[model samples]
Target: MQIYNFSKDNGKKIGIFNSNFIMSRIIETNKGAHIGCMYLEENGIIGYHQATIPQLLLILDGEGYVCDEKKEYFKVRSGDSIFWEKNEWHETKTETGLTAIVIESEELNPSLYMPKKHWDVSSVSF
Candidate 1:
C-alpha cells in the first residue's frame, strides 16, 4: 500500500478566464479501467479483502482509517490518495463517513502522477 496526496497544496493554479481556483489532477486511465464513487456512511467499513486489481482510492470528502495486510491502520482524509497492488489485502473504515473515488485497472501507476506522502508508517495502530 502507498499513500499519495492530491490536496490543494499540490494543486496547480487555474488562471483560465481570470479564475482564481486551483485544480488537482487525480488520475488518467487506460482501456478497461473501472472508475466509481464509494460512499461510506457513519461507522462504515469496507471489509478487508484482497484487491482484484490495482486500485487507487481518492478520498474526496470526510476522513477515515485504512488498514493494510499487516493489520495496521493509518489515518486518511480528504485529498489523500491510497493505492493498493493487485491481490493486496486492505480495508477502509470511518466513524464519521467519507466519499471517495475508486479506480481499478491492471495498468495503474499512480506514482507517475501524484507525489507520495512521506508518512511514518511506524506510528500506525489498529
Candidate 2:
C-alpha cells in the first residue's frame, strides 16, 4: 500500500483545466489507477469533453455545478460522489469554488476485473 499527502507537495499543472485551478496527483498505481485532488477557484471550469475511462469523483469541499452533454446541469456539494462511465461527456464549474478528489484510470481501458456472469440478464435478449 502507498500513501500520499497532497498538501505537502506542490501539484503539477495539467490539461485545459482552468488556469486558476490546481489538480494534484496523489498516486498513480501500476494498475493504471489515478488518485488526485483538484482545487477550482471561484468561476473555475473544466470544459466539456468525453472521457476514455471510467471515473469516480469525490467532492471534498465547497460547491459546484456538474453538467452532461445535453447542457443540463446539477449542483454538487462536499461529500458528493459522481461517477462517469467511459466515453461519457461531462464538465464541471465552480461558481463559488470547490475542491474534489478524482479517481480514474490512466489507461484507456484499464480493467476493473468485474466477474463474468453465468446468466444473461438482458431484457431484450432471450
Question: Which candidate's TM-score is highest?
Answer: 1
Give the C-alpha miss distance for residue 4 in model 2, angstroms.
Answer: 25
What is the number of residue pairs that collide in model 2? 0
lDDT (C-alpha) at residue 72 in model 2: 60
Tens-place lDDT per residue, model 2, 18-55, is: 46555544333556677789999999888888977767
Tens-digit per-residue lDDT, 46-66, candidate 1: 999999999999999999999
- Candidate 1 segments whose C-alpha is farther than 4 A from its true place: 16-20, 120-122
lDDT value for candidate 2?
0.61
Q: Each model's TM-score? A: 0.90, 0.59
Clashing pairs in 1: none
